[model samples]
Target: MNLTLRARRIAAIVLLGVAVTVTLLGVLLMIAAGTEDAAIEGHTGRADADVVSVTAGRTLVRFHTPDGGEHLPSVGVLYPDQLEEGQVVRVEYDTRNPDLVRVAGRGATLTILPVVTTLLAVWAVVSALVWWLRKPGPLHLRKLRPRRIAV
Candidate 1:
């Protein structure tokens, strides 16, 4: 095989490896989301929380438990979509672990669309790249023969 062809094959293999890793990570994210939802449902507590701040990754809130203790979950709320700063919203949390909270009515199912879309996008790009790399090129590029030298 020509050196260029070999290099292309190696690149394709590396990209396939990356795609597999990404897929695994996406699956793990879904599983983690489901686990959190189950935990919150098992020991559920409801509160009207004040949305302290909203960022791309998290929505910070402050809520008071029945015991008059206030909680500001360090990692923020789960499934915190469309929340705005200073807005009051209903939240469900784990009484056993106050830090585990989520926006009321939202569950792990919300994560399915985003995770599946990301995986599909990644695989689409990877498939295209691998196909281009593995496809045969011009006849001359397929193989290179070394010149014979008279001894």
Candidate 2:
């Protein structure tokens, strides 16, 4: 096979591999992000997240979840969000520990998975097809031999 063509084939394979790698990394990141302590099971809890105050780093949101029975949550510094005094929004909190809070339906981090897997699957199939198409020409060349000139 020609060196340039072989290099192209190798490059295509490498690109496919990179796509798979990135997809795997995204999956791992999602798993790590969802990790919570045994004491608190993060579950769906209906609560109000008021637009308290948007701060420098994160928007501080406040919401009340099912406490030991109910009542109110202690208003304090919540990281990742600067909250306003009052703004209504939906939120999810840990059932066991109401303190652990996160925005509902924001677990879309794994959404890139389908796109990455699709790209890799397409590349692998196309790579095989292209290599097969180019293979016949080389074989035909091998079949040809030096011929004597009829003088």
Candidate 3:
């Protein structure tokens, strides 16, 4: 394919934008996890959380605090990789920011694998698209005339 200079430039800009966006998303996920860990470390609360649901990649829990008020985090539990529905698991949450919670002893390190895997997957797709877009087209039929028979 013969791309004009303008088209190539546009494609380059779009690819760069996508790469930056993906990187930013991954970084934000890590940063959010770290922030939550910091919050929990500063002021922690422990409780026995009831696993209300467990799906392919997420788990939801419900629990009561010391004041006997029921609470369920809107985003569900962090580091829920091994949790099962109906199981009781100990959790550590930020008492000051009660919404921030995670399975006991699990922290931001649990986020690394999923973020890295997502980055790798996104880059694989983007690289493939870039390669396909930038690759040279096949030679024209006119450029490949059959050879004449030798005398």
Q: On a 0 to 1 TM-score scale, where does candidate 3 land against the true structure?
A: 0.77
Query: lDDT scores for all predictions?
Result: 0.94, 0.56, 0.85
List where candidate 1 sits over 4 angstroms from the true fold. Answer: 138-151
Model 1's lDDT to the true fold? Answer: 0.94
**Per-residue lDDT tens digits of candidate 3, residues 86-116?**
9999999989877788999999998999899
Q: Higher TM-score: candidate 1 or 2?
A: 1
What candidate 2 gets wrong by more than 4 Å, as runs, is: 33-47, 52-60, 63-87, 94-100, 104-151
lDDT of 1 by residue, 1-151 (tens): 8898999989999999999999999999999999999999999999999999898878899999999999999899998888899999999999999999999999999999999999999999999989888777743265568989999
lDDT of 2 at 77: 28
Model 3 CA deviation exceeding 4 Å by range = 1-5, 56-58, 138-151
Q: State the displacement of the C-alpha of residue 80, model 1, in Å, after optimal TM-score superposition.
A: 1.1
